[model samples]
Target: MAWIFALTIDPVAADSADADFADTFAVIDPAAPALSVGELSTQRGDGIFESIGVVDGHAQEVTAHLERLAHSARICDLPAPHLGQWRQAVEMAAAASGPGESVIKLILSRGVEHGPAPTAWVTVATASDFTAVRRDGIRVVTLDRGYALDVPARAPWLLLGAKTLSYAVNMAAIREAKRRGADDAIFTTSDGFVLEAPTASLILRRGDTFVTPAPNGGILHGTTQLSLFAHLEQRGYATAYETVPVADLSTADAAWLVSSVRLAAPITAVDRAAMPVDAELTASINEYLLSPRD
Candidate 1:
């Protein structure tokens, strides 16, 4: 399906009647062209963004995503975001997105050259179909991130934990995985510890305990994974955060990639080596992820 990029910069100017606006809607457009050629986000990838899963016209974990975005901005030394403005914009787009599954993106960057404030926008678009992959599972391969697990501690300037817009390396890793006939890529440290996927967190099931790499291991603290763990713990399942090695992927009882948009997708194979998995457990976790907390 063709994607509609509806560029509107001012939240107050959202036009709900446009023909190409069904799948995508923008709540803000500042300039006549939306974005300028000199935007730092375009020129230097100097921005932070959050992708939220929208179901039934409600954004899942909006507060969590916004908190992460703020953290990313602080790490990048960008100005603080106007939370009120962002929330309003997101709500506007979400309301116009209809009662279907959609993806909401909150993007903020250092303002365009000579501009006074930050450049921010909220976009709502149709989410991709993940039924087959979510049900059947995926094949994955490990790739070296070329950074030690402790690099984030020693080099804060690297922004290892920040979800900046500079995702070229992450995209390249996934491409290399596809080139090798795999569905996704998991990044391993220079010393051979599992980090995370390009766009999701890794969850390894060892018997009853759910093990995920610590954020200190150079990965994002995934909101979806945290929520799932909370649900599991409330229901008497064990959880842990520790250093996980790539070899563990081969011996784990089950594994999954959890994120906001994809939720919990089982990993059937790692490095072309088939791994044992519990389909019932996978489905149960997915159900919890999709369940309403309130």
Candidate 2:
């Protein structure tokens, strides 16, 4: 899901590789350092991918991850790859995977336009450490350029709802945020309607109400975001799906960027202003995730 090169790695399993990937696509060694995306495979056509966390040798909610991939792919109009092949590849990579935590990414591509069949696959590796995300929280930089949210779902025209391989804008936004001394970026319409974050689902707390952008926000439907909100209702947290103004978040009790990877990254700073995470809200979320559900 993320590729900012790699740092230190601590392995606890026999299958752990030397670094993350000596110089390949996946992580064989977390310490080998990051090579340029020049190595990113281009032989495949555009497709979708899923980032999954494997715990206790079991991939948590794998079906949900796969379902999301399928949804994204279908909307993007990208060629769908065989799920069985992807399963095998992920398992092989996991077998050779490092210890501790591993991020299993399933990347499906149509393969270089050599033929009709799309080439797709999955890669596994030790996920990079997000000490910054875990500690300092997220800094959201609003970008001027924002695409309009296509009201009615257009599975064909509006591939924006899908997680396509063509993420030039998404990646650039994050890079631009860092350049502005912010942790991440979120897009806003020229008219100033706040949209989703580059890599997460936008969320905010107004008074006691936990609110997130409506599905019509036209952003990728995040499983983690949906899961968190679904759990909130059962745990006594009030949540609603609605349109949120960019400025409204500045005065909100708490703001968050949710995703499978970040889980719920607090928006500590927005373009310089700060809004710390609500301690009580954080506790409630942790309790929900750690506790079992029916």
Candidate 3:
């Protein structure tokens, strides 16, 4: 069963510090109408969110996800979330999950136009089964993101690094990829540089080193990528972040699209070119990702 909680109190105010958060949030039916008709999250997609992967009822990497949420709030100019309160809310949401995998989303929306404060909520739902996608892998197409590699530094207003609700382009890219007979997409720069996937971070392997695009270039820093990189480093694998060239994709020994809920789905092909899939390494990565982590 799915669960939803509406945050009734201001999530960031200092006065709410000692207040009972149990009462601060109220359970709501997932099927019920909740947000105002004029809510900016729906009207303008003016919000930030984080989808945390929950395995076996434990919300993985809560602190990392919360920190990223705060980072997005800063980037989007949304109100900073109270970490303690949000942490409690995550605990509450995680408890609602049954056995197997689930997803808990933390959303902070700019409240109704000219309203009092920001609107916030937590939702928990069972995640889709990605077992086949993880094992069988996915075919990916390269779509130009229509920006030069230096756009983030040149245009800070783009808000590309923030995980906002404005995902129309991302979704559209995926649809376009499907239209081209592929499962997903890896966004590239207009000047021929590899960026990331529509919904996941791109990790490429060459020999013993694993590399991903530097997050400084308008890419939303991925929590799952970070954890997997750390796990790789611990397992004696070298990892680095660099500005990957588009031509390098074809030469990559292996590649995968890594995300919070989907975990890691190896890329079977890139633009109709068959790319090697490291099945043993892919399975090991997913095993580590599915393990309980704080």
lDDT, candidate 3, 1-294, per-residue tens: 355333343466633556457777878777688899989999999998999999988999999999999999888988888788899889988888778998999999999999989998888888899999999999999999999999999998999899999999999999999999999999999999999998899999999999999987899999999999999999999999999999999999999999999999999999999999999999999999999877
Per-prediction TM-score to the true structure, in the order listed: 0.89, 0.76, 0.96
Model 1 C-alpha lDDT per residue in residues 217-260, reported as the tens digit of each score: 65888989888898889988899999998888888988999998
Candidate 2: misplaced stretches above 4 Å? 1-45, 79-98, 151-156, 283-294
In terms of TM-score, how similar is model 3 to the real structure?
Answer: 0.96
Query: In lDDT terms, how accurate is model 2?
Result: 0.63
**lDDT, candidate 1, at 198:** 98
Q: Where does candidate 1 stray beyond 4 Å?
A: 1-33
Across residues 95-188, which tens digit of lDDT does each residue of candidate 2 receive? 6555544566776565445454444445555665654565457778899654555543544474666777777788899999999999898888
Which pairs of residues have clashing backbones in candidate 3? none
Weakest 10 consecutive residues of candidate 2 by summed lDDT = 4-13
Q: Listing every candidate in turn, what is its Cα RMSD in Å to the true structure after a full C-alpha superposition?
A: 5.7, 8.0, 1.6
Count clashing residue pairs per candidate.
9, 14, 0
Arranged by lDDT with the best first, the candidates are 3, 1, 2
